[model samples]
Every structure is written in structure tokens, then in C-alpha cells.
Target: MSEETAARRQRPRTLRQRLQHFMRVRFWRMDIAADAWIAPTASLDRNWPRGIHVGENCVIDEWAIVLSHDYTRGLYRDTVIGPRSVIGTRAIVMPGVRIGADCRVEPGTVVSRDLVDGEHVAGHPARKVGSS
Candidate 1:
């Protein structure tokens, strides 16, 4: 590999740098708190640019999508994710959903409502399973 590619493999970019790059390249408008871990495959809604807020120490796993606009409902609202939480692989956070801190959303979940602090949920429509 070339020297630049080798250096890139040796040291991964910081979360801030990654976020900035995504904002620049993908044109996604999101407010991601420091220490957050957003997978490169995670998709944030770009149609509603200013409608996503992620708190510190959150993890958005691969293929996870955080949406902000509901075309079917003809609505647009903010989607919030936590100070400390994990959005599992392929999980979908629907428009306007608020995910509280210390929560864990298991894989393949479809969240349609607000999740309170310390809540752990899974499955379609995301029922409260237990505390995190």
C-alpha cells in the first residue's frame, strides 16, 4: 500500500474527524456528542439535516439507521440518541424517537417511540424488555 494508506490503517481517525468527514462528504447534518462511536455503515437521515442529536459515548452499530422524516406520515422531527447507549446492528430508530441514556437497543429493532433512561428494548415497535 502507499504511505498514506499505510498510515491510515495504522491510526484510525478520531470520532470528531470521522463525523466532520461524514458531514462534509455525505452532507449529513447531525449533532454528535464527543466519545460517540458511529459505525461507518450506520446511516443517518440526510433529508432532514438538523433533526438528529446523539449524546456522548453512544454506539450506532453497522447498518443502523436513524431517521428523521416520515414520508408516509408527512412529518419531520428530531431523533435523539443517548449519552450512553448502543443501537444494535440493523436497528432502525424512527422519526422523532428519543432514546434515553444507558439504554440498549438490540439488533433488528424498530423503534417507534421514546425510550426512557436505562431502558432496554428489542423487536419491532420496541417494547420495554428491561433495564440495561
Candidate 2:
């Protein structure tokens, strides 16, 4: 066995740490909070583990894409989806956007900027559509 692999196996681990490690290694780097659900058809960035954080009670629907890295300049930024937020089908949340709590992103929306709490948005460049 490789030395690094053997040493890693020999180290002790707490249950929580082990679980976190498993989740990071096995799933996409989206640090999804408990009770948050991402549909099976959704795609989240695996390249930047520390860049994605999804809060509790959030729902990311089918074919949604949550990106954290910009390939143009190879930039990395944190992306946050706050509690109780909903990202609808085919939505694309761009890198570095902070979506606040209780926000609703409509289908096929492209979120290119930050969204404040309680915002209901839609369209290509996701604009505020109605009162949240």
C-alpha cells in the first residue's frame, strides 16, 4: 500500500469528522445543510469544495446548475444558498452569487448576481419578479 494511504488509515477519526470527510469525498463539494435537497438531475461543482454552501430547507430542482468556478480566468468564489430558498428547474446560479433566505428562483433563470432575502426572481439575468 502507498505510505500516505497507510498513514491515513492508521489515524483516528471522530464520527462527525469521518462523516464530513466521506461527504466531501463522495459527493460534490456543495456543503449542503441538513434538510436541504438537491434533485438527482441537478449539477453542482465538484472542483471547489469550499465555494458552495447550501443552507437548511433549501430545494434545488431538476437540471439546475450551481457553479463556483469561473473558467475564463480560473477564478474561485464562494456561493451561498440561504435557508428555505428554492432554485427551480434548469436554473443556473453563477459563481460567487449569494442567494439570501426565502428567495425563489424561477425556472430557466440565470442568476448572475447576489439576491437579497425574500426575493422572487426570474428570466435570463434573474431579476426581482414579485414580492417575496
Candidate 3:
């Protein structure tokens, strides 16, 4: 592992962080990394909790929705958010989408397709706006 990553693992967690981790891991059964920060209001797919995979150092901001299942379409697929990425506030990640590392999803954007590494996207249908 990198020195920075090793150092991060050694840091102690606060009570709130521990509680959140417990709820996310034990209760929700999501594959969120130890150092990832998920906002209290972030909505990970509850119906298919095992399908949501969040990588190390990811930040899922408030009201962001990492949706892994679409009941209307009878779809259930994994939604992967790569490491060192940020899902902006209220961003909606569609089912089966694989977001790449170092990407930034702008707020209120609806991501319906896979993202390449270091890509930044915005808009309702999620067009590529830039790269990291």
C-alpha cells in the first residue's frame, strides 16, 4: 500500500464515524471502503445493498443516490464508484454504472452510463464535461 494509505488506516475513528461504519457495513451490507466518507443523507440502494461498491477515499456527498436496482425495469446490477472520487450532492448514479477513479460527478447529475478514469460529467443524461 502507499504510505498515505497506510497512515490513513492507522488513524482512530470518532464515535460518530464508528457508528456510521457499523450501520453501513453491518446493517446495510454495502461494500464501502474503510476510509470512504458517506454523508448521513446519502442514499445507497437498499433493495440491492450488496450491489453497491464504493472504493477507498470516496466521498458520497449529501443526498447523493447510488442506485443499484431499478424496480421499474426489473434491473439489478452492481454500481461501482472508484477510489478517490466524489459524487456531488444529489447526484444520481443509475444501476449497473461503473464510475472510474478520480472522477467527479457534478451535483444533480444523472449518470446513466459507464465513466472512464478521471472523467468529470454533468447534466441530466450525464455528458462528459471534463477530466480530473
Candidate 4:
């Protein structure tokens, strides 16, 4: 393995350490369990609520924000991304949005609504661009 990869693996684990690691790094937390793969640059904010579940073979791209709370109202909810879905780069998934299986959310889309299975959505408000 490369030196940087090896060094990161060897780093010690602690509560403070994990917090610092989460803040400093731009990836899924080590404790986050996923059957899918997440890209290194994908960021999940520290203030994000719990119960973030990603299904099998999902791809969350860089700079995509998946939120589990409505910060303006202080409401907590779960954000579910179904299996084989692709959340494009810089997409903003709002609180309580349930994305269905095999859906493709285009880049820069702000998804605040639940998507049906095998749908393709795009744009700021996120409409159905195509059917899969």
C-alpha cells in the first residue's frame, strides 16, 4: 500500500480522535456501515442527524450533501438512499427524502421530495427528468 494509506490505517482510534478525523477528512465515517461504496470526497456534515442508511452498491459522489434534519425547524428525520442508486456530485438531498432503488439524481440537483423507483431527476427543485 502507499505510505499515506498505510499511515491513515495505523492511526489510533478515540472519541476525540474520531471527531477530529471526521472534521478533517472528507469521506464516510469509519463507523458508518454501508453495503455500498462511497467516494473519498463525499462529505457528510457533523451536525447531520443519525440513521443515515445507504443500500447495496449505491454511489454517493463528491460534495453531495445528504441531510437528515430540517435545520430551520429543528425536525429530525431519516434519509434513505436505496440500492444501486447514484447520487450525483454536489446534489443536495433534503431532510426526510426517500430515494428509491436504481434512481439517478443528477448533479447539482436539490432533492426535497421522495423519488419513485427507477426514476431520473435533475434541477434545483428536482423534477423527474426521465424514467428508467
In terms of TM-score, the best-performing candidate is 3
**Model 2 RMSD, rounded to 1 decimal:** 12.4
Q: Give model 4's TM-score versus the native structure.
A: 0.72
Candidate 1 Cα outliers beyond 4 Å, as residue runs: 1-27
RMSD of each: 7.4, 12.4, 4.2, 8.0
- lDDT, candidates in the order shown: 0.81, 0.79, 0.87, 0.71
Question: Cα lDDT for residue 22, model 4?
Answer: 58
Put down candidate 4 lDDT per residue, 43-68, tens digits, no spaces: 65556535466676676766888787
What value does the lDDT take at residue 69 in candidate 4? 72
lDDT string for model 1 (5-113, tens) is 2343345556765865467345664788746677778888888868988887677777999999989889999999978788889999999999998888989999999
lDDT of 3 by residue, 88-117 (tens): 899999999999998889999999999999
Residue 24 lDDT (model 1): 32
Poorest stretch of ten by lDDT in candidate 1: 1-10
> Which one wins on lDDT?
3
Cα error, residue 84 of model 3, in Å, equals 0.5
Winner on TM-score (1 vs 4): 1
Model 2 lDDT per residue over 1-132, tens place: 224323433445546545654575467555777556666667778778779888877777779999899989898999899987888899999999999998889999999999999899999988899746
Name model 3 segments beyond 4 Å from true. 1-17
> Clash pairs of candidate 2?
none
Comparing 2 with 3 on lDDT, the higher-scoring candidate is: 3
